[model samples]
Target: MLDNGNVVWDHSEPRRGANDGTSYLCHGHLARLREIVATTPKAVAWMREQLEPVKGDFEKTAPMKASSKLPISAAAVDAADETLGLLCSWAEYTAESIGQPAPDMSNTWKVLASADSTDGALRVQGMRSDGIATVDSVARWMLERIDVIATHEWVEDFTSELCDQRATNLARWPYEERPKPAKGIECPDCGHTTLVVFTPAFAPKYSTEPLLRNGKPVEVTETVNVYDRVINPGGSVSRSSRLVKRTKRYADGSPVLATVQRLNYAPPLLVQCRSSTCRAVVRESDWARMILQAG
Candidate 1:
């Protein structure tokens, strides 16, 4: 168990086999435990590196001769405390997984709590050296366990099994869901031109009355002439003319009609009000499509 009350795996003993009154090794469980153990050394190294500069800063700012209290930055203290807390949690988790007793980590917790309690208190001393030593001791204890776990006969096999299991699990996981696209438009309530609305693809389609221009529905007409050759015993040519009608645009430039030019569908979108004081997300509704398309 780690000093933080985390139970670590005991590599010295052989595990019991299932329902046979025999002892055998479970490589899978050991592999998982080993993977966790492997990270401790790196974590300890990182904690040392992080604390070095903080320790230096404290030493420079702390009183040299007397036992006078020195002020430390809350940010620095919080950072150290967070690192320690993570280590503690890691230790506790490791211990719990292996069904072993965890160590008493009350001292480490006190160190973390002291940072908050010292705030607004009188005569708060900076125990930088003590904090560093405590971290160092914890790191050393973790290293010892790492050494023991590394000495297992199947450590290499455990590592390989862990890697395979991880790959298998990752392969089985589903891909992330894509986000809906955002549609921008003018807000009705705030009159903000930059209001954006999110339209989800699964949302039901909506209909709105066709927009008008000069109190009339906008339309367009096209005229085309086709020439045809006719050999009536003398080789002559005849021409014909025709007119085609298609909706183009309103006088205000809004599209009068939209054609299904492509079969591919677009993702849903979100639109938000861009007004600084009235930043609101437009709700998904039938009217939202009109606002998006019209704008």
Candidate 2:
């Protein structure tokens, strides 16, 4: 995957050659390759770089899963085939002009090393030998032809072989994008999980107040103030819970979360329920951006 989420087939061992390597239209060895491209395939670069934080974070434990693959359209295949045909014609014509026989289009050969591997044997499509007298010429021809073929593939899909096209600016979505609240927030008072919502009116508030204990008004500053916005932010969140005894044996603790007060102000939260209940809110760290309906 060249950052465009397109799968890259390995050709390190020269699996594909001009004379006897797998180039389809022959023994059908290219069938698997075609099928791989046809089916939704994952990115190879993604698989190789599963280390998360992605900067090779040695301290981090969980590595990221593989990135998704982009679909390769049949139109792309058709375009590649068409371009290959034209290149073959060009090579053949040049060969004929030089008084050498044009390489037979039907002629195919297999790479000896690839034959024994469970991986299908590598094969090559032939080019007229006249214009391609030297290996360097063939390499240059291949590079140019593949570039053209890859261009068509990119146009058919956003995945491009060219770095310039492949890394399209993370195109901004013209429409408004809003994040969604997590579902099933656990109630602090009743322990019931309920869906949560938030609005600008529900944003957190602050004021100096007296909290009464035993009918005596004691001046206590409550720095941590947040509302449970939604269910546990999917994964672990460094929370604590109280142990519940079940039939005097099997038991689990009721979940409890620590409120992180802001270093500058209070409640070091990115977003909190501004609602009165302030039931429970998620810190911005746990929030995710998603396409949401307008309020």
Highest TM-score model number = 1
Clashes of 1: 16
User: What is candidate 1's TM-score against the reference?
Assistant: 0.23
Instruction: Provide the overall lDDT of each model, using Cα atoms, as 2-decimal numbers.
Output: 0.42, 0.31
Which residue segments of model 1 deviate by more than 4 Å? 1-70, 111-133, 147-295
lDDT per residue (tens digit) for residues 222-289 in model 2: 23434443346766455444444322212364332222333211111122232323223343334443
Q: 142 in model 1: Cα distance from truth in Å?
A: 2.2
lDDT of model 1 at position 195: 56
Candidate 2's TM-score reads 0.17
Least well predicted 10-residue stretch by lDDT in candidate 2: 38-47
Clashes of each: 16, 25
- How would you encode candidate 1's per-residue C-alpha lDDT over 124-239 as one tens digit per residue? 23334435434444433443353343344443454454445334423533122222333444576577575543323132233455445777654544445545555565666565
